[model samples]
Target: MSALMLDPASGSSVGLLVAGLIVLVGAVVQGSIGYGLNLLAGPLLALIDPALVPVPVLMIACVQAALAVVREHKHTEWRGVGWAMVGRLPGNVLGVLAVASLPLAQFNIVIGVSVLVCVGLSMLSLKLSPTRPGLVVAGAASGAFGTASSIGGPPIALLYQHSTGPVVRATLGAYFLLASISSVVTLLIAGQVRVEHLSAAAVLLPFMLAGFAASGPLRKFLRGPRLRYAVLGVAAASAMFLILRNLF
Candidate 1:
């Protein structure tokens, strides 16, 4: 059993610890700006262990999203969330099928490139509103990519790019809370989620919560355009990193 399980003092455990710290940083960014846990940490964690990619990251995201939703419940826009979910279900199913049957490397490459393109478009000042149609389309795309890559925040984040910081954080938080649930369920049904994934998430949960707690003081400093720019920069960098990591 000792050999089978990760020993805390071992190199593998150190890697896990490093991964946890990365998660902590990602959580801070998510708590401050509302959607970055997966984007920031997903790629790094995947490099540490492929099993840590989507499932474990999604589990941690569920916790982070739920906490964000609770902290900013009053700002949630249920109507928009409803519309996004309408499209998310089908997209999620398509994503799950892709994960089950398709070549994941090629699929990930496609997603990475697509996200980079979308982030580029967003940076060009093309305004995407959180309207019903926009939300549906963004939600579907988010579901598809998120289910596959665990990097779902970009689509919805770009849509609400021009909104106020609080609205962006709260609405994205709410959407992520729901979207994480759907992704987890789909992954479970598809036999992708396992006990080890849950174990890894459990080990990393404290770091996530700690980072979130630390972000409370930092959030006040990142309001207005500063917040918007920060979100865009992080999203763009993460997308680019995903593309580069997959290609090489």
Candidate 2:
């Protein structure tokens, strides 16, 4: 990718403010539910400024994941995380290859459609427990999608949706922490990482953290069935948006 692929976003501007607002809202959603930040922020940021994506967005998201891990450290499923990471490492490689060769529209369309299918199946009472094999597959999918598009939570979150809220949040937090960091490293190696991405992340960090702080109440409210439905709805909505954007 050329250096201009992600335009430099510097200085104070209306666009920056708008981007921060989006980040704030997304952080609240993800902070409360375990996954929604990128699904919510990515498209809007692209519309607002191409420079705000893939790197800057992912950076702040890592921060949110870290907070989740710390808050729910006791609830983390370490064995599950290790199993998923087994697949995630390779999946990240595949994602890098996809970004290197696959057409953007094609890649986005495929991911969106795949995610929608998973959501639809789950809605049909398709019970998917976080088994070792299941976690591996989901982890792989998360790594590929997270690295390729930054929408990695659904595959793993959907699995934990049937479980408790704290488990869902903490497990996903642990898994995504590694995924986001790995994706950034991939970008850095590809020569896609830049100072502008860091600057944009710095500007957006406060708003994202504010959203996280504000989610304390909302998180209390969204639990059990509410959280399960949220996983399905957000995953489906995000997938549809991605598909439409690429198609049009």
Candidate 3:
């Protein structure tokens, strides 16, 4: 891979503030439901600059993963997590390779399509429980897409949703934590990691944390059908936006 590079800075204090607010909100969604930050960040930051947006989302995934591992560590399904990691690690490498070969527009299109597919399947109630092959498939897809598009959660989220509540949360959290780390490493190796991106992510970390903290009380207020409908709505809207952007 080539050396990592950043564009001449395309953001200002104002841009940063706006992006940070979105990241915070995304984090709250994730903290409350165990996923959605990337789905949230994608459209919000896409309005800024698509190239720069994925970096912050990826970085924030790392932070969220760390937090998740801490919160759900005791319940993590180590076997599933380990198996999924095997698939995800290699899939991430493949995704980076794919990105390296593609033009920017093509890359964006690929990511958009993948995200839309994930959302569509999710809306249809196809939850994936982690069996041997299931773990592998979900892991590979999540890793590849997470690095390429910052939309890795859907595949794993769908997978974990079939499990019991704690199991679902623990497995999804562990998978994301692992996948997020792998994505950051892959980006570094592929020369996509950038100083400005890292700086932006660092500045926004506290906001993400605050968002996560903010969700604790909200969870009680939003339960069962209400929460499902809200999250599904967000996911569907996100998918539609991605498809529209790709087509336009």
**Best model number under TM-score:** 2
Which ten residues in a row are the worst by lDDT in model 3?
A: 1-10
Please tell me which predicted candidate would have the highest lDDT against the true structure.
2
Tens-digit lDDT track for model 3 on 113-172? 665676567667665466879778878887777777777776666555545444555566
lDDT of 2 at 160: 88
Instruction: Name the regions of candidate 3 deviating beyond 4 angstroms.
Output: 1-11, 103-127, 221-233
Q: How many residue pairs clash in all the candidates, one count each? A: 0, 0, 1
Clash pairs detected, candidate 2:
none
Residues 1-248 of candidate 1 have per-residue lDDT tens digits of: 22212223334767767898999999999999988999988898888777787888899999999888888888888888889888887889888988888988788788777777876777776777889999899889889989988988888888887777777788888899899899999989888877777777877899999999998888788888888888888888887888788788
- Judged by lDDT against the true structure, how good is candidate 2? 0.85
User: Which is the better candidate, 1 or 2, if ranked by TM-score?
Assistant: 2
What TM-score, to 2 decimals, does candidate 1 have? 0.93
Superposed Cα RMSD, model 3: 3.7
Candidate 3 C-alpha error for residue 186, in Å: 1.0
C-alpha lDDT (0 to 100) for residue 190 of candidate 3: 81
Instruction: Write candidate 2's Cα lDDT for 153-225 as tens digits.
Output: 8888888888887888888888878888888998898887897688778888999999999987888899989
